[model samples]
Target chain A: GGIITQTPKFLIGQEGQKLTLKCQQNFNHDTMYWYRQDSGKGLRLIYYSITENDLQKGDLSEGYDASREKKSSFSLTVTSAQKNEMAVFLCASSKDWGANTLYFGAGTRLSVL
Target chain B: AQSVTQPDARVTVSEGASLQLRCKYSYSGTPYLFWYVQYPRQGLQLLLKYYSGDPVVQGVNGFEAEFIKSNSSFHLRKASVHWSDSAVYFCAVSPNYGNEKITFGAGTKLTIKP
Candidate 1:
């Protein structure tokens, strides 16, 4: 059994500020993903990595950057925070790639003032 | 591009009663469907998924979903409801080929009334 851990469960940033969120998974999965969750909006894929040092853009990839420096770690960076913006970012990992069940982290709630 | 739709934004059912949540999707090729549940203050968890073979897939905690290809719908159901079942449910769709990128619905919030 393994767990996906997301750092800084709650995040606060100022408008135009850059913020970064981190994720770590011990599952040793081959793929990692970053998703943004808004109230009633479900989850949107921001970016995903098939393996270390690889990245693929999703529908909502703009204004976000992701890094897969290590197979166990993935990080997301917000280019510029927007005022009154609030959302929860979730990190997930899968054994392989397509059609596999994903293991998720608790998520990091972000609030920009 | 593939998309998913969850018609019901909110659903409330009495405890021990049957439950159903509606979902619809759009895709040109073969679609892979999935149902995910998000408990309060937690990330989404897989409830069930349909790739091929069976149209009806069973999931954890007595949850199940049936895929109706003709209607382009994958609906989630439960024989009985419990208070702990209250959560937000999302329907997702993925393409069959290449690196699959999942598209999710707006989501349906379910509340169990005792």
Candidate 2:
């Protein structure tokens, strides 16, 4: 079985600072996604890429930018961190779009001071 | 637009007892439902999925979920509970068509009493 790896298990950022999170997958999947998890809000999709160099915004795409540099790697950038935006960011990959199963990474916990 | 709701935020059950977590969804077209579990310090794992045909879908670790289209509900159940079963359970839904985002519920935290 393949694995999805996310770098930087934890992140601390100051208000208005820019932070980036990276993800890599060995599954050779065609689709990758970034989701933000809040305490009571569950997981909200921020952005997704169907293939390399493709990006699509989701319900919660504001203040976030995503890049799919290659088939195996995807990255997310927080344009300007907010003090109230402490949350866990998850990276997931799927074989394809639609009703496919999503394989997820452990996630990066972010806190803004 | 599609949406999911998991009413109960937390539930505690005795060990060896039956378990059930409620989930409801709203979508205009056909809905593909899923149940995912998250253990402590771990990423989410799919427990089961309901595409079509049978309403009852079985998942790993003896977990099962029944899809009630009439009620727009999909509830996860287990015959017996164990301490290891304690975790956060999320309900998700996706449109039948491709290129759409999957929406997830708020999730329910399950606790098992030893």
Candidate 3:
């Protein structure tokens, strides 16, 4: 059994500040993903990595940058935090690309002032 | 692009009663559908998924979802409800042949009443 751990469960950033969220998974999966969850918008894919040093943009990757330096970890950076912005960032991993089981981290709640 | 629609924004059910949550998807080719549950202050967890084979798939915690290709719907159902079942449910689809990128619905918040 493995667990996906997300650091800084709660994040607070000033408007226009840059923030980074970290995720670590011991599952040793080949794919990792970052998703943003909003009040009425549900979960939107930010970015995903198929393997180490691989990256793919999703529907909502405009203001975000993702890194897959290591297979066990993935990180997301917010280019510029917007005022009154609030959302939950979730990290997930999969065994492979095809019809695989995805495991998620607790998530980082972001709030901007 | 593949998309999902969860028509119900919120649903409330009494304890020990039956439950059903609606979901609809749009895709050009063979579709892969998924249902996920998010408990309070937690990340979303897969309740069940449909790739091929069976149309009615059983998921965790006595939950089941039926996929009707004609209607383009995959609705989740449960025979009995518990207070712990209160959570937000999301329907998702993998439009591409593989699971590269998935689209999700707005989600339906389920509240169980005792």
Q: Relative to the unseen true structure, what is the C-alpha lDDT of residue A9 in candidate 1, on a scale of 0 to 100?
A: 99
When 2 and 3 are scored with TM-score, the better candidate is 2
Q: List the residue pairs that clash in candidate 2.
A: none
- For model 2, residues A1-113, the per-residue Cα lDDT tens digits are 99999988999999999999999999999999999999889999999998887899988999998899999999999999998668999999999877899999999999999
Model 2: lDDT of residue B104:
94
Q: B58, model 1: CA deviation in Å?
A: 1.0
**Model 2, which residues run further than 4 Å from truth?**
none
TM-score between candidate 2 and the true structure: 0.98
Global lDDT for candidate 1?
0.93
Candidate 2 lDDT, B1-114, residue by residue in tens: 899999999999999999999999999888999999999877899999998999999999999999998999999999999999999999999988865788999999999999
Tell me, by TM-score, which candidate is best. 2
> Cα lDDT for residue A22, model 2?
98
TM-scores for all predictions:
0.97, 0.98, 0.97
lDDT of 3 by residue, A1-113 (tens): 89999998999999999999999999989999999999988988899999887999978999999999799999999999999999999999998875567899999999999
Model 3's CAPRI class is medium
DockQ of each: 0.70, 0.79, 0.66
lDDT of 3 by residue, B6-73 (tens): 99999999999999999999887888889999999988899999989989999999999998999999
